[model samples]
Target: MKTLTAGRLLPVLGTLLAALLCALGPGAGSASAHAALTSTDPASGSVVPAAPRQVKLTFSEGVLLSADSVRVLDPQGRRVDESKPAHADGKSNTAVVGLAGGIADGTYTVAWQAVSADSHPVAGAFTFSIGAPSKTVAEVTTAEAGPVVDALYTTGRYAAYAGYLLLVGGCVFAGVCRSSRPVQRIAVGGWITLFAATSALLLLRGPYAGGKGLGSAFDLTLLGDVLATKPGAALLSRLLLLSAAAVFLAVLFGSYAREDGDRTRMERRDVAYGLAIGGTVVAVGLAATWAMAEHASAGLQSWLAMPVDVLHLLGVAVWLGGLAALLAALWSGEPVRRAEVQRFSRLAFASVCVLVATGLYQSWRQVGSWGALTGTEYGRWLLLKVALVAGMVVLASFSRRWTGRLTDGRPAPKKQAPAVRAVQAATGAAKAARPSRKDKDASPERAAQLARQREALEKAAGRRQRDADEGRSGLRRAVLAEAGVAVVLLAVTTLLTGTQPGRAETEQRQSAASGGARTTAPAASGPAETRIPYDTGGTNGRGTALIRIDPARSGNNSIDVSVTDPAGKAVDVPELEVSFTEKQKNIGPLRTALKRTSAGRWQATGFQLPMAGTWQLTLTVRTSDIDQITEIRNVKIN
Candidate 1:
């Protein structure tokens, strides 16, 4: 009977794993979710009896506020806000701005912009009313970084990624292959590219964040302002680390490379160890510059995500970057040592392991549900990246097979050496026949003939070398194909960084659905009750908030709120605030003042609801010092 061997099973398992991830990778995640507006005081499209003291905004993650982070405009497009936006109640994720006293309100517009913890800028506009909702001339300006600035910034980001891979990979290749000049040149090119790209990004950041044109990139004041923010600070820190990297590179290619052949083995070993440690520090530092400012520093498991992200980047640099160096060495007309190739193969295998483990964890973090993984654009992009990585793995396997053949002493075809000798003999004859410029007896026509013969001999030598490098150059061609796939992989990764994380998009979609209009039939003559589920994404954060409104019509209504754990047990929270808003006639975020009555319950007596319609109910719950969520739901009032 025929049976499946381990080799056959390996491919089957890999196919199954890919299928599983494509269908069920919701638990795999990314920390780079863009910040989402969770709840707002007064609620968008609501009307109030009087102008609010301030407009408050809450987000899913921390945001960096600027002078004009939140702006309130009157119906006539006049600024009515205090101009300085500050964190509400010392909360890093909340922004609040005071409105000018006694300002007449109609359909007032609120425009807000902030840089999220992941270093991406987000902006939005909404309308609310006081006294009555009316037509307003104040228009919401669509906030966006102009096309020219966006394209330039994105290009800079791509260059930065490429430069980092080249710089780190080239250095590693030099260490492993012991072929200094060509690989070192690759490293130097990487450093120059990275340095230039980083400088450009720093200048462009100010304009990018503020949605300004490219001309504003050079504004000194804007640059100063950018320097104060977390993202800007991260970029500045990267610049400093790059300076240290320069020193590291100089030592590696200069003093380290120039070590005398007469030196003792012990001395050489010690010097190599020191360089390894120093290079590691510089490499990890450079990786940290990105981790601190991007997705790793923001979302769930952030404490662990940052370090893992650094490792992920280091793995990519070592494998893809090293592959590039190896490719260059193969085609440089230099004899490549068998041991160097074997050592790099081992390192590449190890790097792939690290990448896989960390990548799965990150994927789980960025995507929390199957729906999110399959439904969002971010998810689609991630799948594409996975497919590309899989292709690379296939190509790598072919390369490994060729490497094994070389190591196992498989004899290459015997035609290579004779080809090399023939080319050398032809080149020698051409050189012997060429006459020096000082030989006045030689005619110009004879000299031209010799030069053409020399060119022909060089071309013949190249063709011969190409024919027998390793019996059709299997290893060389395989590595080349792998390098091509890696280039595409890196581009996808750069684009992924700019896309919104699937988890964030899912949350935003849910928020919009919850806040949408509800056309429920008028309630009977009794209390109207609703149970809304809330998850703050913290410890014991999943639960239901039970709300009941007594005598649910217009005028005064009594509200009672009770919180519960997922297991149906009462759970007490640090704080809870509820507000109601009516969108049709544009009335009320009539906030309720509640007093605690029990371990997980609160009641507000004789609160006014005024005229009744389909109203939005917003509930804010804080579970810990930093864990909180705002939920909005629609309710019908008689």
Candidate 2:
């Protein structure tokens, strides 16, 4: 029985030990994640001759612009912009600010914090020189950013760690607890901890991602808005999936455990429960990864990018949790059926493999190039995580070999005792006749006794080997330790994802460019020459007025006029009037003399100008003798 037990456990122990070392290694550090800033306006640092009338910013995705979306400050740090920032031309992704009049010649810094349509907060500041400006004023105070948001962010991470620990611990307890009652207690605690952690994450999402908090928790309007945004939609979908998983777990706990079932039935129940719990945890992990990617707005169809991320997170949870359970089984030594340990070991091995594969793919996608791995903070952290995972694989391999050797049953070597001498006269006479010194030293009785001792030594060696195998339970301890390290790595990952990666570098590049200035020469141009003529077909208020405009260049020109009420039964007091720029002016109280020529036409020659550029036109229409309507049209000259 001892031999069989030792054979069964060696493999499991070896695998766990390897995993622990991997978790503690630098690879764990490299696996952190976060969003990156792609671009900004004012080109980071720039110089302009005059104060611009407005400031505009464009982002990688659509953004929601409101009163606090952006702020402009003078060199002395005084607020300059008066009106709240608004979406430029109703574009959701662009923010525009109207500048106040007092903006003088000086260096001005534009500090902006925009909430992406996906609910992620992105902030940046740029210095733009206004006529060799120097003083700076509009600084972003940390308090205005809100304390609740920061606290929520920190708490959410801590809760994730706690939840992970409880989950692993519960799995361990379930594997090894002698009493069903203790197993139930551990399971319940695990679920409760997981629930609390997930809830914390949900609450923190709003504030950390630039939302208003609990008031918006159940706001259907906010939900609708979130759905409209890609990041928000993805997160909401993941949460719903997680909720479904939670429901499945509840049902399994409430109904499945109560059944007295055969092995097959029990196995089915176990699978169902595992799926439910695993799915929920996986969904939560995917959502976290999405938040880290910063491309939350990519929509649900971004499966090509998201699947690896989801798999990476889910695989980590399964591998870590399984290791904990397996370790606990080994530690208890009793009550842990060997078959159960073997089953769990197989599952854990598969999970570790999956984790490694998905992690590699995700790392490739995020880091982009080997240079980024060494040059960027995100890349460095990812490298650390990869190293840890590699170490875990090596450990798992060693354990697998140990388990195989133990499980392969082999009998202990046989022992034989020397035959006892026959007490015959012939044998005594033979021994007396050969009584030399050598014969005395190598007596038959003594040789026979030594043979018996050799057989005993072999039996003792077998017993000791069996005991050593049973006592060396390092694998289980190593697995549990690895899981704890994984928790810390995950926390660091969360923090890295929260920070902006290339903001400082971008700012520096902008500053260097602004230091140098250049000037360009204006081109010379020609002069303007014009000619005009007027004619009348009749003398009465009903008469036709003709005017022509002939430019020296013989190109397109325009004419305009203002006319008063004409006293005529046919004309109806000149109710409607139209005019073009650079044409006839106010001609009379009753009529205006503007017309096209034979060389041009008989109509208002300059009225319908054919050219490219802005062409201003004014129109007046009288509703009644006392009431009138007037409008100006700055038509596009092109």
Candidate 3:
């Protein structure tokens, strides 16, 4: 029982793995492209030293200005930035926002949306305070997307990918390698699945992007919005490519399936040639849709990256999908030729080499560093994909060994078992009826001849059973196992497609290093956040001023001030200055010149406090050209 279980384990595992692969392939079609916020002039959560002329944003990739939108508002939700389309600077990913008028003191929120170079739409918002944050009416209302909607979107994408592979693999397998009924069926199914998946994704995009629930997937209004974008356009292109592929597939299957191969060899050869040329062209066009709508067309070196990604997709389809076809042929209750297996094996090897070369380039481009492989979600999934593919390669080598057995003449033993059983029956009966068995040599009586014949038949049947069962190698088991592991690899590949790339972190860190206060003196790092409010008396009367100190607590801090009326209305004060004194340490007053950022905001940076203690800060508020009032406040630092 142990031996039998051990012998069948690999094949059982293979079948199960294929099933899991089928399950995994559909969800792997998550957004291949993801956009990360790189940097803004006033960093997210950074208190600027002063209000700026304009808000500048730099992303990791060049984006579509028309499809992207940006908005900036003060604490009162009054639009401070111009309400118009944002534009990208020449050759740079930076988007510039023109200020509508002067900005006042308070927390300001910048909400933005962009269609990245990879054609995926992404959005986010961030806040920066002036003197301090006020009761800002601004909110990040888009909120977290529903999990069900996300899952459905991802599943639809993966389904399309799976369908693409099946259709493409079936063509390569049937046209060039060998023809089989089961392979054709798989190819046909692939076409249908691809069509369905594309339709579903096209409909789902609008709702998903709008942050609507799963139930809104069928919203026609949203669908129209999706069709107007790049992702939708890519999917539409894929459908057209699939339609062309269907025509080629029909021709190949029809010609190859005819029984009179010898009589119409030339016609079939022409069809095969057509498949090699036309099919590849169609496959490349189809693959381009994915690449253009994915990471390959975004971020760094997009032009060169796109071609590599297209090849990578094609290689994967041939290798992984071919394995699936091989499994079908093997279990088709017909002889699988050594020639067929060897042919596929060679092609599969070349495909794998291409996959490796392209995959390495992609990994380097997306991950950026070795640490990111473990540090980022995308990296971790890539690791899993590599490990699974490695396991499948090992299993495939074992299956290849089984294919070699076809030439070793091992199958002859089962064929000869019946002939050997007939001879055994005659010999056994003669021996049982001999005189030597009954007396000394045992001779059998004529009256018991029928019983002796029956005993001999039983003995012969048992011997034949042993012969037929014995030495029947687990070749089927190896193939099944190989197929199963390959399927799992496809699933892992799907997951990697949907994950966020690690390169995003590398870009963001670099952007942070060069932004805002981080570029100056001891202010190389942002100051801690602290907001202090005080009212300056006059006709601008009892208004609240918010003070923001970056790295606010100790060391070097950058100061910003925002003045607003009690009700949070902008009050453009004329002149404002701040002085810091560490009184307990007997430190003299250190005055920093204020730079006007906007009408209500002032910035002063690069003031280093030598010690940690309670510091007295004085704000000289000039309401008019002549009248100035001083407001004093104490701030503790450690």
Per-candidate local distance difference test: 0.78, 0.46, 0.66
What TM-score number comes out for model 3? 0.65
Q: Give the top-scoring candidate (TM-score).
A: 1
Q: What is the TM-score of each candidate against the true structure?
A: 0.76, 0.53, 0.65
Candidate 1 stretches greater than 4 Å from native: 1-32, 407-413, 433-463, 517-638
| Model 3 root mean square deviation, Cα atoms | 19.0
| Residues 1-638, model 1: lDDT tens digits | 00123364367448535654754544543333577776777776677899899999988889999888888888777899984999988998999999889988588878788889999987766667898877566655535687688889999999999999999999988876655677887898889999999999999999999988988888999999989988788889888989988998898898779968888889888888988998999899999989999988898899998999999999999988888888877766456667788788778777877887888777777766687677665777888888888777777777777775453242344745666676577667657656676543668887677778778877666655654556237888888899998989998999888877878776664543343322123444567798989999998888999999865654335689999998888889998999987665444565776878688899874354533467899999998888899999988765
10 Cα displacement, candidate 2 (Å): 19
Per-candidate count of clashing residue pairs (backbone under 3 Å): 15, 45, 26
User: lDDT tens digits, residues 62-126, model 2?
Assistant: 66554666788775667888889887788665788888985788766666665654345655444
TM-score, predicted candidate 1 vs. hidden true structure: 0.76
589: Cα error in model 3, Å: 38
Q: Report the C-alpha lDDT of model 3 over 1-638, residue by residue, as the tens digit.
A: 01113355456446534533333222211122455455676765556666776877777666655333677777766678864556554743677787765678777777676666665555656566676645466543332336676778778888888888888888788876678788888788888988899888887776666666777777776676777777888888888888898888787788546666465678767766766899889989989998888788776677888999999999988887777776666555345566777788778877876876787777777776656667665777787877776676667656655665554233354666665666576567656655444454334465466566667766665444333422223455776776677667666776677655767643443443344234222333433444556555556656767776654533334577788877887677777778777553334365665667577777653344423446688877777766667888886544
Order the candidate numbers by TM-score, best to worst: 1, 3, 2
Best-to-worst ranking by lDDT: 1, 3, 2
